[model samples]
Target chain A: MKKLWLLLLYGLLLTISSISLAEEESAFNWQFGVGLGVSHNRNLLPAMDSPRNGIPQLQLLFDFEYKNWFAETPSLRSGQLFGVRSGRLLDDFTLGYRLSNSERHNLALIMASYHDGFGYSVASGDGISSSKLEGLHNRESDFMPGLRYQFYTTDNQLLSLQVNKDITTHHGDMLRLFYGFRFEQHNWDLYFNSELSWYSAKLVNYYYGVTAAEVRSGRPQYQSGSGWRWHNGLVGVYPLNKHWITELGAGINWYTQAFTDSPLTRNNPEVVSFVLIRYVF
Target chain B: MFFRYRLLLLAASLFWQPAQAEALLSASPSNCVTLQQGRECHAQIQTAWTISQPLTVCLYLDEQQLQCWHNTASAQWQWHFKDMQSRQLILWQMTDSEQKLHVLATARIEVSWVQSAHKKRLWRRF
Candidate 1:
């Protein structure tokens, strides 16, 4: 399975040069900002309680183009890799060379980045019974090489397709399709994003499958197949003059049978929401 | 399963590029021409021209170029400066009847615009 994913990724990289080439533009432009927000996280484990935690948001936007070589952030939706709480702040960080960029449409980028994975350990007094989810090994982080294609339907709408293969440990692969729309009214800027993500069998099994050694009487050894996850959300930011802005967002996630059927997971969909206020500087 | 149709979708979208109007060679003042808050000193393009004719006198604002053509053998041509905007880059180009282009002159004015104390930047990624 890993070999197949590697082959596909290699093929994608080979086609980058044939796609739209990037135009040489000005260089070394960047933006920086900091903010804070509060999130209402939905606990994945039914026996455990989720927390309302305050999270800090920091952004460093720097991009430099020396001829065709370019490095910037990959535009990806924020998602939880393991259960509901385990997430990475730099999920969309990217370093790549632009294959092609045009004014009207079509952008092709080839990038390499670190892909995140999940690890769950039930400690004492953590409010969960580890015995029920025995033998579920940790999914270590891996470096992935990927191809991204973005279609700008307009200034306000976009469609993106990305395929990536993990090159380090588990060698799993993922393909995602995303659609985004932006609108502004009365000083409020609103953005809506919808995504469909497909994970390989190895990825699903490694993260959710129960091993034979750790399986108790109620926890049968299980193997999960490939699965799909759907997520949709809306984010709104209202800028008050030039220095202050307020942001709010909410999203829902639905896991397929491949993940929910596992003994370690529940059947309920997850809901995550947050609100933020920032002083832009 | 979504991967099955990716190539097909991409191929279709490649053909959907919208055509843009030709850019004009004319120039205008940015909203920031007024030295006040929320305004920056910049020149905006007003028209685009495909120069296919001979020109005698031309006018320029900032880096923007506007051309002119004269066909009559005897014509009275004179240049005029009508209330130039602040911090504007001005240039003039002349062309002979044989369609030879030449730079006539260039000049600039200085203007100060109010600067905001709060720093702000907005960007989007997809």
Candidate 2:
């Protein structure tokens, strides 16, 4: 398995080069992009109450970009054998429905998965072996819905507030609200420049907080309850002269599942980092 | 009856591959699987490419060359091992021109001996 990881890194490099070949045209319309990224959960299983550990993750993001998609970027690092990273979009899609006079009300739905390549979140140390690495039960997913008032702050930036919920058969599920500032001056480029998010338990437990009873019975180990997690990320995209894009991002999420734990727990909360590449068509 | 039960136990083994498949040189699955004990196993490689670059695919079950491929399309790589018995770490690799690598994915399937026919039917199906 260790040797296999090295080869996959080669494939990732190819994916990056392919991005430079993306179609170029700028306009205010509908566009679709597919992104593949790897992330790690700095925090470990809640039961461990230790500092957050790491879970290497992979994901697919689909954005409905409004207008032309032309942002490009230079290639970044050719990830390490056990490289752990995370981040958001390079170029994302937005939806706009005209409302009132010149004001447009926008709505966007987002679906993302944390392919916990590691299997489970155990802060302990290296897993059982370099071979099995981690189990598949550790991977998870999330969905988000937001209401936007573009031009609310100015014609170039928008005020965005959103609520997102994560779902995992036995990992983490939480609700978080985002208050963000965006830079959307170009059809091909934009930035949710920065944002602050608050996560409530009523939101997170729906995903991460499973029980021993469920596992013992062979029933699914997902307990839909209330819990909280907190984290914030910056989304930026640089469109290169060619079609490729460089996505630079950083985020830190804290899971409160730590403070409250029984023998059955998911993980402690902490911060993590994200550095990824994107290719859109 | 006991020996027959042991026979069924020997039949359980996870998928294993040989390193030769690494020759495939592009992200994809395994071609040849190495069974540590010659047990029944199933494995295959699936490739996806965003580039026109011909990919080289390879599979490694205990550093042995189980499978190898030199395809010219990124999405043209794939492999699988079927009904084999073995217990070895399986490694699948794909390499490109830049020498960079993508961790396409990995998995571990362990075969164990069981005493009940009832348990056999429940655990043997993936």
Candidate 3:
């Protein structure tokens, strides 16, 4: 219900922009772009060998200006609206404000309400429960109130830092902090994102509820413990002849786990590599 | 008398042509360029006439930023590449702001750059 209303409100706002046949005139430009990319992250852990492949990612970004809409607003702190799917649709509708202007240094305030929702099926034979939320069903709204900053060198290379607390919990509390950077080239652009997610053993014990047989799989380390997953990938789009783009990419990911007084300690390593052809107009 | 008003409307319609152009433009070979290394090669493009005004849609290699315009008296236009890569087999398009038309076309260019080696009696059976 919240997601639907938000989409409706944004749609109404976008419709108003088309009233004028002429583009808007201002110093700070308000632009919108929609891109669709398909990615799959495979689990190579010996205990968890199921290939959870095929993730259709949709990205919609906006540049909303408060002072000027057309002039040069060259910085990372510009307010943005973004979403993510870590197996759950995390719709983050945030109104961010830039704090610093220096390219080498910047900070921003991110006030977003994250609608965390996920649904899956479980077989009775496997002794798993299968249930889904109906209209306004098992839903939890998380206030992702966070402040992140960026530091860079004279060359403008990016160095980032972010720390946020997850207020959605049943047992204890969950905390997360992430840091990464961006690198660009004439023939390609590269961005590396690394995130460290920690789940309080008390919080994990209440959610995963892994069985004894599942515990024998040696995957008990990540069940109620802490771990870090590293996602390092580079995507390059070179012009083929003006109308199309030849996209080449390769990425590597590794996750290490430390369970809380559990019977499993799993160190997982995975790799994803593919090439795609894209058209940009 | 109001050229400004007319141009604004023209641009809007041109940008909107991509929705319909997908149907007409989606037909193409999956892989068109099969050459490893190459010398200069040429490719020709022709389009159906849809508008009265001369539609000079520019040609782009990988993006619009790196492109050249084609002045066609008729709807059909042609372009050539001096040097080609594997990406050359990819599709090319013709687009303009004046006419509400978008032309997407692909070409199968099997090039022969081994002319000098073929001239040798040791290699040629002839």
Report the C-alpha displacement of residue A48, candidate 3, in angstroms.
9.4
The CA lDDT at A89 in model 1 is: 39
Give the TM-scores of the predictions, in the order they appear.
Answer: 0.55, 0.35, 0.44
lDDT of 1 by residue, A14-51 (tens): 34522433432233233333455565556444423233
Query: Considering lDDT, where higher is better, how would the candidates rank from best to worst?
Result: 1, 3, 2
Model 2 over residues A1-281: C-alpha lDDT tens digits? 32233234323433443553355322222222334444333334322222222332333332222221211121111111122232332211122222322443344443323222232442123333222212224423232223333234554445555554444333333333444444423212234433334444434343344445335432335544354445455555544312344454545555444323522333444433444444444
TM-score of 2: 0.35
Off by over 4 Å in 2: A1-28, A32-62, A65-104, A107-152, A155-157, A163-175, A182-206, A210-225, A257-269, B1-126
Over 4 Å off in model 3, which ranges?
A1-27, A34-36, A44-95, A99-101, A111-119, A122-143, A154-156, A169-186, A193-227, A239-250, A259-267, A270-281, B1-126
Pick the lDDT winner.
Answer: 1
Tell me the RMSD of model 1 versus the true structure: 22.2
Q: What does the lDDT read for residue A215 in candidate 1?
A: 76
lDDT winner between candidates 2 and 3: 3
Better of 1 and 2 by DockQ: 1
TM-score of candidate 3 to 2 decimals: 0.44
Ranking by DockQ: 1, 3, 2
